[model samples]
Target: MSNIKSSKKHAIQSKKNNQFNKSRKSLLRTLIKKVDIAIIQKNKILAQESWKILQPILDRFATKKIIHKNKASRCKSRLYLKIKKIP
Candidate 1:
């Protein structure tokens, strides 16, 4: 679907970028799950640690455009709220 030589190169670049982004997104999800599991288990310390790990990953994903800026904000907000609810 590329029209020019540069476009073709761009296509390849995009593919590589997609692979990286996908991995990043997957890792973020896993980190979020760890946080959620901690919250659900009422492990406040672990939840805090997971949040520390997840925040930058969320920012990185937003920066890289794999996920929307607002989505990251929403997720972070919800995660914090859940953490607050934990004992």
Candidate 2:
């Protein structure tokens, strides 16, 4: 579809970036779900472990601009509160 050679290259690069971002976001969601499931199960140790894994990934994604900093902080805060509330 792209007539110019540079345009074609750009399209390919864009597609690659799109797939990479998609996978990264999916992984983020999966990790968050794992933490949530642990909380639902009332497993504090599991929740904490998953949180340990997820926290840095959230910060890293924010740092990479894949996700907003506020969003990352918000998720971390809410999840932490939920985990803490689990008796």
Candidate 3:
């Protein structure tokens, strides 16, 4: 319970931002799952293709400040390594 009206408004805004961030987080996880599934199926081409699709979603999420840039970098790096290591 915010005492000041301004604080109340800030709390409302914070809730809205939290919802938006959660949606973005969900989308990121879904994209990651797509890549992981492709990798598990051992389809190198599919994994590579999924990575290309996932990259933009990741970049947008990072740009919106939903996730850290370095976190995105690490994820993309690991995916690339896995896809490349596939024979």
Candidate 4:
């Protein structure tokens, strides 16, 4: 219910951005979960592979400001630790 034309456009753009961000976040969570599941299953090879895939995706999200850099680093650290302990 935006009255102004610019406001209407902004609303539409906001909705698109919101959807995009949500999908990205969901994908990030899924990637993390894949690594977690691999770790839980004690599959070291799979865990390592998933972790390798996850690290750059996390860094990209951090770079895009979708997620905090510290959070990304912390997650990477924890995942790496878990992978190391899998042996």
Candidate 5:
């Protein structure tokens, strides 16, 4: 509850932004999990496809600051290595 008009507007904007960010983060996590599941199943083609889909989404999120750039890079590196290890 904000008394000032500007404060109320800010509060509303904050709430909307919070929800938007939460949904984006959830989508990012789901994409990451899809890649991880493919890797765990040892399906190289599926893993590669999933990685192709996820990598750009991850970079986009990182650019938007939904997640840290380093975290996104680390996840990409680790997942790529796992995919490569699959024969």
Candidate 6:
């Protein structure tokens, strides 16, 4: 429990921010999983499409510092490689 008024407000705001960040991270994971599933199913076209959608989402999260830039780039690279090997 926060004693000061400003501290209480900060606690409330922090909770809200935490929820928002969690949802964003969940959505990012879902998107990545979709692409992974498509790849596993050997659906080249579907994987390609999902990869296209995922790239910008990764970039946005990276820009917002939700995930590290290097992590995002690495994910993109790995996904790209998987897609390339989908033949």
lDDT of 1 by residue, 1-87 (tens): 868999999999999998988888888889999999999899999999999999998998898789999999999999999999887
lDDT of 5 by residue, 6-85 (tens): 99999999999999999999998898899889888899999999999999999999999988999999999999999999
Task: Provide the lDDT at 60 for model 3.
Answer: 81
Per-model TM-score on C-alpha atoms: 0.89, 0.93, 0.92, 0.90, 0.93, 0.92
Give RMSD to native, each candidate.
Answer: 1.5, 1.0, 1.0, 1.1, 0.9, 1.0
Tens-place lDDT per residue, model 3, 1-64, is 8799999999999999999899889988998899898888889988988899999988887887
lDDT of 4 by residue, 2-84 (tens): 79999999999999988998999999999999999999999999999998899999999999988999999999999999899
Cα lDDT of candidate 4 equals: 0.95
Q: Which stretches of candidate 3 lie over 4 Å from their true place?
A: none
Candidate 2, 13-73: lDDT as tens digits: 9999999999999999999999999999999999999999999999999999889999999
Instruction: State the TM-score for model 1.
Output: 0.89
lDDT of each: 0.92, 0.98, 0.90, 0.95, 0.93, 0.96
Ranking by lDDT: 2, 6, 4, 5, 1, 3
Error of 4 at 44 (Å): 0.9
List runs of model 6 lying over 4 Å from the truth.
none
Q: Give the alpha carbon lDDT tens digit for every residue of 1-87 in model 6.
A: 879999999999999999999999999999999999999999999999999999999999999998999999999999999999988
Error of 1 at 47 (Å): 0.5
What CA RMSD would candidate 3 show? 1.0
RMSD over all Cα atoms, model 2: 1.0
